[model samples]
Target: MTAADFQIDDREGGSVLRLTGDWTTTGLGSGARDLQARLGEGRVTALDVSELGRFDTAGALTLVQATTEALPKDAWASRPEAGRIYAMVETLERQSAPPPRRPDALTRTFAKIGRGVFDIGHEMLLSMAFLGRLTTATGGALRRPGSIRWPAWFSQGERAGLDAMPIVAVTNFFIGAVIAFLGANLLTQFGAGVFTVQLVAVATLRELAVLITAILLAGRSASSFAAEIGSMRMNQEVDAMQVMGVNPFQALVIPRLAAMIIMLPLLTFIGMLAGFLGGMLVTWSQLSYGPSFFIQRISEDPMMGTHLMVGMVKAPVFAVVIAAIGCRQGMSVAGDVESLGRRVTAAVVQAIFAIILLDAVFALIFLELNL
Candidate 1:
């Protein structure tokens, strides 16, 4: 093997390139690469390869790359034997066309927005379809009450609702305390520090308790449902159930949905009490207001019932959204660990978004109602 020779002969037009030596890996690969770079600029209009010594795939690739770079003109090997190797590489290259270049930033941004809108619409349709299926399953169960799985309902309720009590309680407690502290801090500036107790009670009972609890459940129970069902799907257990003349919707999904629907309100009620208790603690510690005064203040507030009712009413909807999204994503999981993980994550994201969207809609409705 000898060193690669890249001799350029300038003419009135462009130039002629004489590619000599081995051009193989054992030969001057560095020289070939350098030659490739020099010839890449479209300066070489012709190629001569009669003197090309040792040849291999490596040599063929280097030559192929060079000749490809020499566009608007063909770079033919002077010797016929080497022409076959070049032709083979050229054929392969031609068969596999280069990918199109990435779109510009502006085009990509618009495309991304369009895709996002489409995805939202698609998911909404899927969710509605899933809801319809679930409703049908529920109606079937109602017709034959004995077919309803009470054990599964109890088990799911325990896992999703009962087991989540401590975290929900403690979390809302602190949240309430923080809200009271903030209210006191701000209202004190206007000589309305006493209204801090009112603020905590209203917010805790009306919005904070239910909203935070739903968010927690979305992260916790929703993820659990997605993972559990997703795993079953991955293992083909869901498929096995269907094969056995069993309804996955009744056995797997309905119980979870019922549990969430049942548990969310219960949890919300628990959370509201906890938050109010926390606010009570903060009120007493920070402002020296006693429990009796706090209780009396809450009783005197006319909007308290309206606010409490408003927040509680949203729980069932939030529950259905969260459970449905979790189950839907789970059912959609492909037979792979990565797919399961991805679906579980998507379930959480979609559940949270739905919860927030529902809350905002509730707020608007209540605002219009003047509640």
Candidate 2:
């Protein structure tokens, strides 16, 4: 077969592209580039394929792409196969072409912001809906105590709370120690280093213990719930349960929710004690305050019990938010690995965010009430 070539003639009407030689794979080497370059020099108003030889799909594609104008009908009269190939390749190229250019940068940024706001609103609505469903399910279980899954509740409690005790205890211990160190360092300058006892006691009992424990559960238990339920979703097990006249919310969600509600407060109590011990040890080692003196100082603090009660009050709320976010994200997962992963991540993030926001709201309400 001859090498592909094209000749451009300056005709009276306009330029004419006359394709020649073999346009098959091996024959079309430089011809594609030469044809494109010639076409770029000036627009060809007419196409001539009369003398084209040894044509194939490759040759047709080259000819179709070399000029902007459509192939003349008469040019393909002598070569109907070439015409068919050209038509096919031309249609495919048109279908595969890139989309129109994107909006300008400012417009894109505004669009992104708009989408983000919409997503946040949508997510809030979904969460509220989930909470309503959870409340309804809980009411149903309360009406018929036999529907409550005690075994599942115990199992989830063991996993979410009992297994998490060590990390929560250790983390809060260090947090309390750090608070003691900072308080002593600052108060010593004002001849008030002894007040460090009150600082650690109030901080740990009122905020640190509960907040830290909730954050830990948000990361650990929330992720676990999302992944477990998301896997169930991906496998269509949740669907099967519905078909079998089962309520997934009762079997799967309520137990976890009950577990979190019961276990988080217990964990927070443990964290508060651990934190007090840690602070006591730090004060004994860093300052000259003995364990007896530390204990005495904390015991004498009038607001200590109030602080403890306040912290305890926040746990159930935090528990509900964390468990609800996790279960909701799990239920939202599509039948895919990517959706499962995304939902798991979103569970942790949304739980943490809700925990912090709720904590801030609690702080405001307590402040207003002079608590």
Candidate 3:
């Protein structure tokens, strides 16, 4: 009916606050604090709000605080709504509440680092467990070689090794040629250009061939394996196989692993042959020596056997690591398109990193043994 306003009436026991107009917080005027301070200066007895127009929490609190510690019960019983709120406000103990505080930047930074480390450890543990399962499955299949699934093995071998031949051939050939050219250029100044043949042969056989092949498979075979197995997981086909008393490892994982184990060494040999030819081409063009002389130099090297053995031995190990990571990531996939994509990417990254790490370890071991 009217704009919010109120007045204080001084009384014997305390004060009788009389309200009129709209007594909401918004319209209580700039004098709201002054009125509250004056009301709280001494004792207050009761609030007479019979003439009140509009009332809200702000006005209710103002009326209640104006009253003394021993506010009369009869004063509040008159208006049920405002009285209930004012009574509730009176019981609050402001001193008991504490303010909220935020964590500092350093604390948050350390927390994030701790979480990241924990996630890495957790993932490594999961991958290791999967590797264990695959190892056991491989042994179990060995007892009955028929479980190895020769068709899948042949298919995967063709897919990973044969199908990948063109890229590996072209790339490694150029790499070998580049190495030879660079070596020939450096050695020509000293009349030692022929040594470039031995350099290309030993380095390509001992490191570059297998290393490049493994990296390629990490990207190619790993992503393909993850995608194929992840599709089965997403479609619930893996579950279906389990229900039918079929071991997915025997049917899927073993064949892929077997294929990789057989194929990688053969691929490495092919890469080495192709890379040698490239180096031979470069050496012949630069040093006026044909492939016969290049082959003779490489053949005369005493360490050639050691280099070939070292490189060939690493292939199967790298193959298993890549295939295991790929299969693990695939089987871990959740039944969603996004999860399948994520797992596939993870498979490639994990496989490549593991291969590089394993290769480095092998290098150190061989160096220590003087191989």
Candidate 4:
């Protein structure tokens, strides 16, 4: 192939650029750059591509870029092929150019909000779809109990429930103590310090214990589930399971869901006992009310059992939300460490938010029912 070359000759009106030899990518070499530099020295009024041997898009782009002004319609009339290629390049350049003006602040802000709303709606749809699939898998497992992975269920239960007891108990205990202390201080002003026992019992049994336990699990087990399953997804292990005809929901998600279902209620019960103990101790220290007095006061309250029942009933529901959100986020992970990290963080945040939202719903329902 002949090497590409260009010549600039002064003409009557202005300069004329004459492109010659093979203008294909392999023949252009430094000739393209040299042509652009030469064209920058003077305005070229006309293009002469009649001698552009073996021309291609590369040469067309170079010629188009070298000329600041648009080429005349007949500039490449002799080389119709070059005219077509040049037109194609020019069209692409026009299409790829940036927008003329940036959006204003108000427009940008609204766009961002719109995107956030859209993302939230999309996420809700995805989560609902995942839940549907999970339900189907669970039904299948129930039909064939032999396919259930008991060891995994037990292992997850121990990790998420038994191992999490200390932190759950400690947090609830302190919360209860604080509530009792506040009640004693405030109630004493009304000459009703003895009512502190009833306050502690009702609060601990109806809301604080279960709420705190669920929040703890949201931070703890939810992140763990997301990370574990997310790592599997990243490593393509989930895909392998699918290839082997294994239901990822049954093998991975169901066990974790089952564990959470079985363990959270048990943990919440433990948390309630710990909170009661803390409240009793605080009441004793602050009001000179012994543990027996605290117990007697709580036991005598007709609504205490109802409060406990309300709290316990929320446990399983909260557990399901936490497990489902975590596993769903994990399944959505891309095959990258960054995606795994992001999904894990999202799992914890989403779980906690859902827990709070559901708790509010439960509270409203119980209030309406006069429970």
Top candidate, metric lDDT = 4
Writing each residue's lDDT as its tens digit, candidate 3 over 1-371 gives 46566677776766676667766877566555566676757766566778766667786666555454645657766677766666666666223366667789999899999999999999989988888888888899989876668888899889988999888887779879989999999998998887899889988998999999999989999999999999999899999999999899988898888889989998888889989989999988988889889888888889999999999999999999988889888999998999999999999998988988998999999999999
TM-score of 4: 0.75
Model 4 off-target regions past 4 Å? 1-100
Write down the worst ten-residue block by lDDT for model 4.
Answer: 35-44
lDDT by residue for model 1 over 1-371, one digit each (tens)?
58766677887667787778876678865767776677555565677766768666677677667665423234453456566666776677667778999999999999999999999898789888988898899999999999999999999999999999999999999999999999988998998999998899889887899999999999998899999999999899999999999999999999999999999999999999999999999889988999999999999988899889998999999999889989999998998999989989999998899899988998898899988
Clashing pairs in 1: none
Q: For model 4, how does the per-residue alpha-carbon lDDT over 1-371 read when each residue is reduced to its tens digit? A: 89998888988778988888988888887866787777675677887877779888888788777877667769888988778888889778756868689889999999999999999999999998998999999999999999999999999999999999999999999999999999999999999999999888889898999999999999999999999999999899999999999999999999999999999999999999999999999999989999888888888888888999999999999999999999999999998899999999999999999999999999899989999
Rank candidates by TM-score, best first: 2, 1, 4, 3
User: Candidate 1 deviates by what RMSD?
Assistant: 3.9
lDDT of 3: 0.84
- lDDT of each candidate versus the true structure: 0.87, 0.91, 0.84, 0.92
Ranking by lDDT: 4, 2, 1, 3
RMSD of 3: 7.2
Q: Which candidate ranks first by TM-score, i.e. highest?
A: 2
CA displacement after TM-score superposition, residue 343 of candidate 2 (Å): 1.3
What residue runs in model 1 are displaced by over 4 Å at the alpha carbon? Answer: 1-22, 25-28, 37-54, 68-84, 94-107
Off by over 4 Å in 3: 1-103
